[model samples]
Target: MTRKLHTLSTVTALFAGLATAHGLPATAEAAPTGQTVAAQDVSPSMLSAMQRDLGLSEEQIHRRLAFEATAARVELRLSQELGSTFGGAWLNEDGSQLIVGVTDEASAALVRLAGAEPRRVARSKAQLDRVMDELDRNAANASASSIHTWYVDLPTNSVVVTAADSVMSKFQAENFIARTSGAKDGTIRVVRSAEAPRPLYDTRGGDAYYPGNARCSIGFAVNGGFVTAGHCGGVGTTTSGHNRVAQGTVRGSSFPGNDYGWVQTNGSWASQPWVNNYAGGNDVVSGSSEAGIGASICRSGSTTGKRCGAIQAKNVTVNYSNGPVYGLTQTNVCAEGGDSGGSWLSGNQAQGVTSGGSGNCTSGGTTFFQPLNPILSVYGLSLTTNGGGGGGKGFVSRLNGKCIDVPNSNFSDGVQLQMWDCNGTNAQKFTWVGSTLQIGGKCVDVANASTANGTPIQLVSCNGNRAQDFVLSGAGDLVSYLANKCVDIKDVSSASGAKLHLWDCNGAANQKWDYR
Candidate 1:
């Protein structure tokens, strides 16, 4: 997979645009585009696309264009002198300096000769040297029963060496510290071999049965349900509340490659927009927008409950012990096994679900999560509360008392309803007042908005818009704008096309729909 370099200027512009659209303060500093030059020197289309997508002001665009030109010149000189063996080059996080990585001392010297600053130390190389020196020094003291393992903790910028009880073990630790005295802070803790537990979820706790227990926070609530991380549970899995009271059932789930799911519940469990009740206070769920690396984020889970960290990288692919999952964002937050499906948020906005990570809060580690936007779009689910619950009105029923004509038009249990533009027709004339959209007197709804498109629209006790929005046509079956299809049950029967198709309405029983 190709890794795209994230441009700081683009990120700034995106934030500015979002701020402007949402009436928030524009907190981003404007970036320099590049040096002025001939039109032939730049890719006009690429420049235009950046400006549009990134929402760059003209001055910012021009400045960045100039910066790019100068950087290109610098790149050419460095490449020619250092040859193809040079490692890589990237702009610093501030976009003010260029960092070029060279393979060895020779390449580093060449780069410096080319008028570029070259730092002598490579952390990885320095680490390897320290390790080898320690091993060689301790070889004479090595005993038959010794085990050693080395690992890097990027968050703390430290290297850890785990070893079994032996003379070599003590020697290795002392020698490593002595050789790399200048490399890191001189703080090392020797943990006993048996005390170092492997990092994986131990699903042995009774509290693990709740959604919060699994670390998955609520995204959005639909008519009769809410959506969350699929890895938390599978279809038909029973769920309980933090207090261990029966809450809901996993209506649908998908994991490994895709991480998303939805749950349907009775009225006893009311959905809220609140996330973690940190010792300070309960964190709110605001809205969802993709945040850039270096942006601050907070998470709420059952185990490590609530914590804040910065986003380290986006679109990272992680191979967990369970399986390979793609498009996860890495962070410095600490999470344990039960926290797998927990909520990851930027400020009050929804970000993603905690997938997995190495390390713990005590020692520090890297955690990864699946982004929420794609999951919402794919499954056609909305995040319930922006910051997690309190700010907005609770769930409303999409169908209540309106009008009904066709007998089976009231969807049977276990199907989803879509919204279509209302046309004054009896099928579309439902009054959505409170939590439920009422037609005549009954409530119309979907069993659940599972990704399966053919899920039917049904009538039930009013919940809210989670199942309400509907599109109407003067001469055909009512369509759902949410699902982008017409109201149709699983084909009168559950066969292949028996799954409803949103054909041009011919005013049939399958097409007519009434909220009540």
Candidate 2:
């Protein structure tokens, strides 16, 4: 059978990404001693979400959850036993073998004895940490954009600095790291990147918090209030909720060194552990359990709602045009302006706050976030959910995380539906209500309730009519209950203007729906 080709970098294809983290450190702190996941305890919703986003079977999801748990324990043991030599650890692409990073033959031997595979590298975690810290210090007084970011690349076992190919002073990045304690004689590589990251900020409106004139998303609700990106505002800055009503005040804020902030809300608003799913539901947060490298992750933002992806790397230092922000976790999830301070959740556990990233949801991109544990520890704040948060959005591609957009925001009655780009706009939003895929409380109806192939789907006032009912098939097809016909992308085109209509289910990509 011919397989559908997809951009593996997308939220829908996060698990399919080929380049796993070969070099990196913990994105969040290690699981508390003796803490490990047991697949039996994994939530059904979380498992279902993994199935939807990663294209894994229920059995695969269950098995991988156990593997992730074991991987976490093995990583912790290697981290403790190997000490500075422990570069990183991740499950191989198939999620079967655990690959550990070691800087010496001795450490590799130790890892092999622990029942894992070990890859050798040049710089130890200690050496890489020192290099990043030095770069951070040097970057403090420098300009932004010259170098987008720098981080320990455990794959190559060095510190990788990112900048556009057009950057004339790319050498400055390498030279800066060279000044680190052992970088001159150690490993530090410079690579060209596509876009420079900036703190997601906007002056417009949406589901966001306001600090004076600046607008940003709420990361996650905590005990006293919520957490967000420090770049949104500074300490003592007053804020307003999405309602524009008096919201809260920034009790503490930090940037450059670390991009994080917390807002203590007023009595008008209280915390809720539930995060609103843009697709149409609320996810219950369970705990702040740390996921291992290469694990699946999702985010929630006021601008994008929710999106999914996998954890790419950790201990990263990002260089925004403003300056360098240290200790960030990276992912391939796309994020846009105004998405900062959003929620990044991994299997119901709050991950981090959206920091900065390059790219839009349309074309795809990379993003970073301030991990939740550090933020929680720093402020002594409690996540509203049973789990914890760093708070960000994938701005993912799930039905709940993404939108089944109308082409170009045009909402004509007969306009053909398209899976364009997802943004927190009314035109792009979709809600599954009762048995219907709804928009603005209108049902996604079949043209005349016809069973004929190629009949268009449109919006109409919802009734109990069976013609408005649909089912998402196991193969990801949105099949109408009216005719057992599948909602398909007309002509199988993935372009922005592709029209959608009912067709026979054939397990095609255009017919597949990922509603996380």
Candidate 3:
């Protein structure tokens, strides 16, 4: 088979043209435990897409990302702490808080200390997983046409059997559940659904790669190439780029049971730490920290552009017409034909690649993604990230073209930054490493990790705290992720000795920088 990829080069060129563009961190100076960091490098277009699809305001989107980031951390901590007693965790409807399912009062108390609300459940996550495993083992003996899909719904603490919406299908579903061990233990719940899931075929003009005559979206850039849906192509399949140029060949593929594949590109192509925003630009891929259930997630595909919704469930088994695929994450985000293998993200964190689903963006539909980590692990591939090679290094300033300088060339911790004439010296240069800005081995940090207005910017030891994370928005603002505030010159001063601080992002010249 043969395939073609979208033009990431075009995105690069566009960004380069806009660069004539714009443009963090510190402290062990750490954030408060479990505190949610503000959204980083969230593009205007990306935010607009989320607002349109998720019915949220811009402020709401920011708040939700912060809450979701914190919730994911809390979920991870509680899941590890509770172990077998952990029933599972998810975000609330609005994503304002995390709700953990606990099988014991002791576990519930532990969850509370983690700053998550706990709900008592009869079964632990391990027990529910066992039930789901039993059903998966018996899947070959069951009717896939009758049971459209099945998943371990963490919120309900039960294995949800989504059967086809027909009387005969319902009858078969009941029989199938009856014969399963979960039915005997009352751990299964049956529901009717009108879904006929299938792998989306075809791709968008510039964002798709043709696998023979079939088309699918490019997932994410890996060290040597990019990953996509396994169904898109088989191993050793030759491929081309969306520009119709010679591209690469599929190196690994897993379908039916899994839906992920990676292609090994030729030297002509370079993998980038970017996902198409579908707005003629790219969204920076900083890292791949997974988001918790009920958190808002967005997808980028050639066919649909960008779509947003909440994660509905994980560890889902969808019985497509061809076969059953396991370990897919489910979402309310709508997808369509030709949208398969696209990118899925929760805020800037890469989640997975599109698999198969039912419905379209016009109405509403359920979508699934093959989680990214598993793909990377299976193929022994390294994810390309902004911290790796995508970010820039240079003087960063806006007004009067002053540089963000480290006084006296000092590299000591807690040295406040000041504006200076652009002397093209090392002290005036900053390197963007992922979401953080660094100068002289130290990060540009907000003092005490404070998010309050007027918090002075200073030098601090390299740390991955939000206090040191900053993003150069496409519009030129150098904003801090800790509070979504801008790195502003104190009182809009352009003097060589003007101090730097954090303030409300007002799009003023002082808040903007030429760091892109």
Off by over 4 Å in 1: 1-223, 386-516
TM-scores of the candidates are 0.41, 0.63, 0.70
Ranking by TM-score: 3, 2, 1
In terms of lDDT, model 2 sits at 0.65
True-vs-predicted CA distance for residue 308, candidate 1, Å: 1.8
C-alpha displacement of 70 in model 1, angstroms? 26
lDDT of each: 0.46, 0.65, 0.75
RMSD of 3: 12.9
List the candidate 3 regions with Cα displacement exceeding 4 Å.
1-37, 204-206, 388-516
Model 2 stretches astray by more than 4 angstroms: 1-53, 181-183, 202-207, 387-516
Please, what are the lDDT tens digits per residue for candidate 3 over residues 282-316? 88776676787898999988777899999999999
- TM-score-better candidate, 1 vs 2: 2
Per-residue C-alpha lDDT of model 1 across residues 1-516, encoded as one tens digit per residue:
011112222222322332332222321234234412221122233234334433554444444333332333344334433444443343334333444555567656554443334544344333433443443344333232332333332223334444556677676545544554433444333433422222234221112346544534554453356666677778888877656778888888877655667778767976555444434444545445455444445666666656556666554434333444556677777777666656665544467766667677777766777787666555544445531222222121123212233233443443334333332333334432222334433555544654246565556644444454442322223544334345554344322223333443344565554322
Highest-scoring model, TM-score: 3
TM-score of 1: 0.41
